[model samples]
Target: MSEIIGFAGMSHSPFATLLPPARDGEPGGRFLADSTKVGAAVTELRPDAVVVIGPDHFHANFYDQMPPFVLGVEEATGFGDFGSTAGPVPVASGLGWAIRDGLAESGFDVSLSYALTVDHGVVQSYEMATGGAGIPLVPLVLNTAAPPLPSLARCVALGEALGQAIRHAPDPGRVLVVASGGLSHWLPSNDPRDPSVVGERRSSLIHGRQDARAFAAVREPRVRAMAGNPDAPVNADWDRWFLRQLYTRDLGPIVELGHDKLEEEAGSGGHEIRTWLVGHAAAGLPLVWDSYEPVPEWITGMAIGATFPVPA
Candidate 1:
């Protein structure tokens, strides 16, 4: 049976690619350096494949038809938005199919895509963790952006199911799971369901797949405009508290924190922590090394963490 070799949870932002920090000492740069360390840890483990659990930024799934969870079975392509990787991403179809079947049997009812297109959410984290080594991967997307999201407890349960699926796969091989996104930041204009959200941006958020290029052209500028905005919120306290829970292997408080309470404490973008919760539950291991920084320039409380590799 294939065993989980390791797990990583990290923050991702377009600015990490589009507007990287100039020096290693800067917040973004420091985060990048730590990310490299995480990548090295992944390399040392020599995983056969990686499963990336991440959130979409409306670049793929939109309000037009959003599912709670999606697993890419056949292939995945990157949108290359904000200068992140574009074009074909290597996929482990055989293992992916096994995971799909296992999830179904486990009562997940996860959505499957023959051809999935993802943006920086999956690409950025995968590239950072693997250093773009082209290791085969399976992409699992969570609906963190849209409302009526799966509850935090549900996410944990989903992760547990995923763990069971991986363990039961016929040829699971050594696998690494990477959870991408969050640390507490806000993107006020992201939710189209809000009454205040109107005009072309709102339409794009709801139906971006219809004309992805146009939506990209419109959305990129707005995101760039927030670069270095001092007023942008990043709840460092909340971020640290969340990390502490992971390190201590006590997720009860986190799982009990409802979605509304999470938003109130960590902001809308903090919803991305759903991915981390999934990764933690799936790996079933306490974090060994973790770091955090509130980077206003990137408009997020940046963080990176990894669990110790399983013994061979």
Candidate 2:
């Protein structure tokens, strides 16, 4: 039988790698130190393949037909935005097919894509976890930015299904399951739905713009601007409380929080935690490592966590 050897979650904040280090005593400084420990564990646990549960920030998915969950079979590649190279990454296709079939048989209507371009979520996670060691990846994309976000309960079920699928893969071997993104974060400027935030001109450019390139031209610049800013808003209290929920192992409070409520409390970026939830459910393993620090420089309530090996 295939086995899940480990699991992890981390902040894919672009600033972690893209921007220079924050000054000592800054929140970013403290958070980066914690991140190094997570990276070190990734090297120590060394898995044959990685299954990354990451969210798309309107980069890969559009509002018209946003999939709550998607599995990239055949292959995967990324835009090379945050200190990662732009190129195709090897994908474990045999395992991908197995997961696609397993989840379907399990009654989860998940989308399977032959071509999916992952952005920072997968890129940063891969870099931090493996340091570009070139491990094969199985990318699972979750839509966190788009409205009508997947419910926390649904995320749990999806994660469980994913865990089952991984075990059933043709050659599960040693798998590193990663839930990439969140603790809690809010970026008022990055909300895609708000025309006012990006200004009416850019909003009009994005309004009903079906061309991916056209939309990206106007959208990506604003995204980069927000990411580069150090004064962006962050809710440290919310992040701390969320971390407490995880440590307590009572996700009841988080589940009770829907997308609307999460947006209000953690900002639009808060929805990224659904990716973390999926990995959490998949491993069904308790947290072995966790660090929470609100880094406004990254505009994310930065955090990371991993699961200990379950006894055979």
Candidate 3:
């Protein structure tokens, strides 16, 4: 029996399109483009099915009792600078059902929306995963910034519950449980400007083997007295806890796909994209992290948030 394959996290940064020289004899477009590396990655994992959990940038209002569950989505032709196959994506609705039941079992009243459009984060991720072809999906919508968004621990529970759901699924091999986004760099998410900024940074500051150390350095935190600093925001600390969930037994050493700072939007900082991957342990090397490093002075005040998961 083939075991389930896990894809722990990634924000679907668009730069993936360029890494592999496009393979010849492959279709090119939103759903057919083959001159990309995303293809090889999946072929390597070779899963029988995929289950993706990505947070929606435009999450539906959670406060509304009448919230419409988003069961589907369609995007423009050139979302991530390419298009392959879009979907009549078939979600293993069971997973969402499991999440709702699991949450209720844990005592949280909430609504589920499957009626969603994949913003670039999700769109890019799926395309990247399938090597430009659309994969069958069970889309799990996470409430990223909503008032009643699942707590970090609750989200982790969601993962644990989801693992159980997939094991019970009729067909769940190569079962990819993808939690997209995050791992440092600050930017306000809204209408972002210039995807090129992230692309260039990936090539110049982070991607090459030579800059690997610099990349980890930026992700580490420095301990300091609060009065000595202040620019650090609450979200980074919060993200530390959330991103930790991506490291699972079914998931391992995360690959930092890319990271960058978008330009300011209306004088506010731009949204940041930090793409990464944590795959099945049996299939990959052990995981390494940047959290234990000394925090940079620029973010020392917020660095105190390094303690996300309470020692159990």
The TM-score that candidate 3 achieves is: 0.47
In candidate 3, where is summed lDDT lowest over 10 consecutive residues? Answer: 300-309
Instruction: Choose 2 or 3, whichever is better by TM-score.
Output: 2
Model 1 gets an lDDT of 0.88
Better of 2 and 3 by lDDT: 2
**Would you list the rank order by lDDT, best first?**
1, 2, 3
Ranking by TM-score: 1, 2, 3
The C-alpha TM-scores of every prediction are: 0.96, 0.87, 0.47
Instruction: Report the number of the highest-lDDT candidate.
Output: 1
Tens digit of per-residue lDDT, candidate 1, span 16-66: 887787876765887888888778778888989999999888788888888
Residue-wise C-alpha lDDT for candidate 2, range 1-312, written one tens digit per residue = 467887878777877766646588765676667656666667777788888889876556765566789899987878666555667988878778888988997889788889888878787877677667888888999988756678999998888898998898877488888878875666544445656645644453335235545566665576668665667788889877776666544566888987778878888788898987888888877686577777776788888776752221
lDDT (10s digit) by residue, model 3, range 218-297:
42221112212235432444345334533443321122211121111101111221122212221232223222211222
lDDT of 1 at 263: 93
Q: Per-residue error at 92 for model 1, in Å?
A: 0.8
Best-performing candidate as measured by TM-score: 1
- Write down the worst ten-residue block by lDDT for model 2: 200-209
